[model samples]
Target chain A: MKTTETPAPPPAEPGASVSEVAAPVAGPPRRKKEGAVLNVFSHGVLVIWAIMVVTPLLWAVMTSFKDDSSIFGSPWALPDRLHFGNWARAWTEANMSGYFLNTVLVVGGSLIGTLVLGSMAAYVLARFDFPGNRFIYYLFIGGMSFPIMLALVPLFYVVNNMGLLNTIHGLILVYIAYSLPFTVFFLTAFFRTLPTSVAEAAFVDGASHTRTFFQIMLPMAKPGLISVGIFNFLGQWNQYMLPTVLNTDPDKKVLTQGLVQLAVSQGYKGDWSGLFAGLVMAMLPVLGAYIIFQRQVVQGLTAGALK
Target chain B: MQHGKYRFIVGFLAVPLGLYALFVVWPFIQSIYYSFTDWTGLSPEFKMVGFDNYKRMLHDDIFWKSLQHSLLFALVLPIVTISLALFFAFMINVGGRRRRGGPAITGVRGSSFYKIVYFFPQVLSIAIVALLFQFAYNPDSGAINSFLRGIGLGHVQPLWLGDPSLALWCVMAVLVWSTTGFFVVLFSAGMASIPGELYEAALIDGASRATTFFRITLPLLWDTVQSGWVYMGILALGAESFAVVQIMTTGPGGPDYSTTVLVLYVYQKAFRDGQAAYATTIGVALLVVTLAFAAIVMRLGRRERLEF
Candidate 1:
């Protein structure tokens, strides 16, 4: 307990990384030798993990360009020549283009819906004092812990009864509904943190409640919106179970569902190279997005867990 | 001002709340009610059959197997993943040598690079990860067996997903591989908030690396660790496990039902077998297990919160 509450040291060294600062405190010579050996061991383990993570992904890309026989012949070898044709075959012939478009449509509609609806509810819950306010808030949050599969069971029939089982719009509505729990949970907390001064001032100027939320509060909540947006975007984009059960239409299949279906059906056709091409094609966009937005992605994901 | 306040609040909450009720809350309530009935989900007309499904679940071999596997997943995946994550986080954040002119603590060289690469799998869908590993675990032309034969382990060949004994562990390994990085990144963030002075104080006291970690870092990071446990356990028992098992295994949960979990069992029974009511029975059991797992972790991990 004594060690835990030690005050942060004065910033005697200004340019050091946030992770560690050279505390301007010296240690005995014995610690130096131990540090030297520990550095090597740490690097060794980190390097091994990095290798383990990258090798399979790289192998998938390599196999995508190889011919069928070569993929089986030398799993680790470079392709004899680049086969951009395999990608073409996957894109057009394997209907990956269709799956990609369906995914975009579903995730796009649902993301926008989730953000709008989630923020409205979050704003009201955060700002207003109303009847059953706590009840409504916990109702949204309780959805987070219960098994979605349990809901999904009756959800299937409800969707069917509503004539929403296999349609893109139906899928979008369900996505928004399921996504509401976390979105509201996150943004309600975010809304409460915003200084009430701005919104209160706007209310004093006689801006209607709806107008104030749309113009004033929404723009102010941009950072929180972006964080939870990225979270839902990735989740809805990679979704498989919902589509597998609900949207079983071949033409409406999302990327993850389509690829798994392809692997299962491609066994008879022996289009291993095309299948591998399709697999890598589905991975590149999100992987590239993460590389570009690496920092925000980590913050968005970790923030939910930390809270 | 007071005239429209209630109306405004109701208008704001209406759509999201209504959608949540229709899709999420209503279904959850209906499933619990369905669990005691005899609805096949084919025609959806049925009568209540009290405790029949529960009674059958007790005697059913497949139900027991799935329950056992689900329990294993919830128990083993968190321990293995979190421990590995904790070690890597320590190495990356606090394991560097105390350089002569540098801070008293630093991560090893290239910490950022390792972090970036380790996080690659977390972005990709688990379905994609499962598929990639499925090919790699191929007995004949897959990478693992090929590497083994390449290294003169020519006489040794193991059917990874094909053999029942090895199949479950292989599936769990994929979950661990795909998930550990997220926790590593999570723990790294937790460690970053710890003041450098604490570590400096420990170093000045002649404490070894392991001693400082167990004594200082672990206690400070306890809350994050506990929450991470619940998060990972819920994931292990939920859709993530369902994706890997359905995609990678032989019968999609078989080599004689070796890798089938409660989620997979629920899926198979409801969708494939047309036993929706019975599926809800199993799903209710799963809900019980999931909540129990979380409650247990929270109870066991309870400790004095260390303010820093």
Candidate 2:
């Protein structure tokens, strides 16, 4: 893969000194002009990309509100009027509501389970000296690098053999299990960074290990939890591959899987508008959550990679 | 403090470890073993077939095709996505001209807005993004073709996901669109930590924009970039490719398995064709490719650390 490193542009003329220390008042007019051009070029490129990223999303939202004819006929046109009917139909008839509920139940159960189990494990791995600690820590973090699809084939059967297939709790358990890798990996590092004094003091104050964790350490680890929490929240919420394989029951499908199913079925039923509505409906919650929690979301997602 | 230390460790470790071992680790081991079996996945009874599945895979045309496509995804996606992200990130974090009373290095105007808007696609599920782009790529009445027509380029219309020749590119483009923002944000964070004094020094030496970037930004950001490459490459090979190819391409994998990736092929083989053993064989190959990809990138990217 070519990294595409460009040859550096020739250096500025030696005699033309425009460094801030050398010339505070004004750069050479030529330098000013060059800066103006580069500024426009950079901003222009950034703007175009921003547009490319936003346009399809806005199009999906617009198409969701349009009639079938308008949607098929004019791909770029705005809907003549807002069609609340599409949203209502999608919510009630297309089973978007059911899908949303399933997603919430699955993500909620899995997120809470992941954080509790993951942080508990991470705290111990970070703090205590114990036999097999290093081995166990590597074991959890090892899941972070391996391709999950490799495990998923047998995992499908594993879940099925346990009579857990196509069940909400089953999917929740699988989500938590899979999520533990990253959550543990991230929170382990995070837990290590935290001050050990308070937890030790809590332990000395006649608190049990569990009590210290629940009260002093857990609260102190709030920032780390929020970071990894948002990470798992988005991941479990948007999860498609896991549910697609394990939870095939129509009633149990999560939002992402449900939306794809709707698209497939809606194609034949000529419910394009409703499909788009469902798409938008499914898209809104995460996007909204992201916008509101933008900073944390970025931090949460990037934290693993940065480490 | 030491009274029940073992108990505390076991109590905390047991549940998560139990769940992970049962679901993640055990299945991983089982899949490797299953790769050698003659199990149909449809039936419980089966005998060890040794490397029969692996032997079949060597001759299997679709397996080869999927591997080729998967390799292509792993190679090309990271290059394109990382380049775009690095460019956007540089513009956002370091490409701006110095403004009055501002630090020597600063992002262009509205960089934060661009970062936010660019990240919109990353927040949405890949399946949802794939579905959106599938419509956009529709050859007949899709946004792309109609947009071409609007621009008076009606004579030139390409069947995006439908045309096998262009189908893979279309899917790759969707991935690039969805993922570039993530790396942009990631590299931005990397760049944010870089000291402004480096840029100031470069400027003092009469370094051009390109010079400062190649000399200062890229070297310092090398570690993040290397890791990001591996991360993106894995995504391209694994779940991300599965969603986009499965959801977007019709034929499901496309005009004639042109877009069939290893993950999709694995899903289809075990789930659709009942070739569970063979599916695991392919899964094993995928795991190998993934590891090899990570290892090679890391090896190639290893360089003397540029301490700030």
Candidate 2 similarity to native, TM-score: 0.95
- Alpha-carbon deviation at A244 in model 1, angstroms: 1.1
Q: Let me know the DockQ for model 2.
A: 0.49
Q: For candidate 1 chain B, which ten residues in a row score worst on lDDT? A: B299-308
| lDDT tens digits, residue span B1-308, model 1 | 46478989999988999999999999999999999999999995899999999999999999999999999999999999999899999988998766567888888767887788888888899999999999988889988887777767768678889989999999999999999999999999999999999999998788999999999999989999999999999999998999999999988899999999999999999999999999999999999999999898998886445333
lDDT of 2 by residue, A121-159 (tens): 999999899889999999998887788888888888889
How many steric overlaps are in each model, in order? 4, 0
Candidate 2 lDDT tens digits, B4-94:
9999999999999999999999999999999999988898988999999999999999889999999999999999999999999999999
Off by more than 4 A, model 2: A1-25, B304-308
Q: Write the per-residue lDDT of candidate 1 for residues A1-307, one digit (tens) a residue.
A: 0111122332521223333333324555666556545655565656667767787898899999999999998898899999999999999999999999999999999999999999999999998998899999999998888888888888999999999989999999999998999999999999999998988788889998998899999999999999999999988988877888898888888899999999999899999999999999999999999999999999898888888
TM-score of chain A of each: 0.90, 0.90
> What are the runs in model 1 whose C-alpha is more than 4 Å off?
A1-29, B1-3, B303-308
What's model 1's lDDT at A257? 91
Q: Rate the local accuracy (lDDT) of all candidates.
A: 0.89, 0.87
